[model samples]
Target: MNDGLAAVLAALVGLVGAVGGAAIGGMAATRGARVGAETAARATARQVQDQAAVDHMHWLRGQRLQAYQDLLAAYDAYSDAVKAVEQWASREAGDAGRRPGEYVQRVEAFLRAHMVIRLVGPVEARTMSAVLWEALQTHAFKLQDWALLVERRSGDETIAGAREELAPARAAMVDAHDVFLSEATRVVGTPMGN
Candidate 1:
């Protein structure tokens, strides 16, 4: 009976050892799986963030392109209007009535185009764009004043004075356009029209 009791005690010890080993191994596996899952979650989150940044940059590029296009269009329209008004002033007094509203429409178109610049232009480009707009506005005002004087059949000296007033504004507009183009190229590659 003592030998039987010893044998049973030995078997019981073996069973306890096996159970403890299995519990420890299972805990180790569970901990490893938890760490692996956490790693995967972090990787997935980083990928998603990277993708969002790429998408945002693409959208911003498109906006910049459109804004640049609009600004160029505005500049062209304004420039043509100024030329037209100058031509009208040079024309015979009777021919001046043919397109009295054309210059005004062009100025309005230019003002409308500025809205796009405000919406999508980056800070550097925006500053240049503002300078361009102010110069164009000054040119437009001087052109309008000159047109009025022309309609009144004012002397050549008065008309020449108005024309002279436009020179500085034109120079400023050209300088601003050049700066804006340079900044835009830095930001979005060469401009479409160029």
Candidate 2:
């Protein structure tokens, strides 16, 4: 009877040891799985963040390109209109001069483009654009005045004086355009046509 009782006691002790070992192993496995899941979530979050940054950069580049194109088109249109006015001023007094109203559309287009520049352009680019626009406006006003004088058969000296004033304004506009282009290239890389 004593030997039988000792064997039972030993068996019970072994059973408890097995149960404790199983519980410890189960806990270890659960902890490992939790750590793995956390690592995967972190990796996924990092990838998402990286992808968003890339998309934002692409969008910004496109905006800069569009702004540059709009500004160029506006400047070209305004310059052409100014040239037309100059041509009209050079014509004979008896010739029918172009009405100032004819150039209003081009001026409005330029202003709209200038607003776009303000919206999307870097600070330096915006400043340059404003300078160029101011110069263009000065020349446009002078040309308009000259056109009026030409239509009224004003003296040659007065027309010549207005024409002389346009020279510096044109030069300033050209210089501002160059500076704006340089700033754009620096910000957005080389544009089409250099």
Candidate 3:
């Protein structure tokens, strides 16, 4: 071949190689940048999700604490109620007989004590649920029926009636507490479940 034509063909081949190399490099860079961007976005999304979960848990804990404080106030009010009932019974029912008005006071005291003491078990159950709420849903409801038992033991057959009584207040409190915890637990553990 003539030198001129050979030189022209060599130049054309070099130019084509340069263009192909640049295109390959550009494609690689695009692919790498896309992967890096996706990775960063995933990390950011996960961080945000984790932070939101923490904030929600803090709010729920505050709610649980408020419930507990209300329960404590209820207990204090019920204590006052017991004292008032006793005094009233003694004054209103006192009489000399096989069972004087004092007997009514005794009965009232027994009922009050019964109601107050039953609170102990429900409080314990509620506390347990709160402590474990972030972990498991099933555990939070393991004692679902226990709330009814607590009411029955306090002498209320109907659920609403139990709420009217003091012991049933604690039982209902525990039930509410458990419900909140169970919801949280279900949300938290769902990913872990499957």
**True-structure RMSD, every candidate:** 3.4, 3.3, 13.8
Model number with the top TM-score: 1
Give one digit per residue, the lDDT tens place, for model 1 in 42-82.
99999999999878877878888878877788778777877
Winner on lDDT (1 vs 3) = 1
- How far out, in Å, is residue 98 in model 3? 23
Question: Each prediction's TM-score against the native?
Answer: 0.85, 0.84, 0.49
Clashing pairs in 1: none
Better of 2 and 3 by lDDT: 2
Candidate 1 local lDDT, residue 160: 84
Worst 10 contiguous positions by lDDT, candidate 3: 134-143
**All candidates' lDDT scores?**
0.79, 0.79, 0.47
Model 1 has an lDDT value of: 0.79
Clashes of 2: 0
The TM-score of predicted model 3 comes to 0.49
Off by over 4 Å in 3: 92-124, 127-194
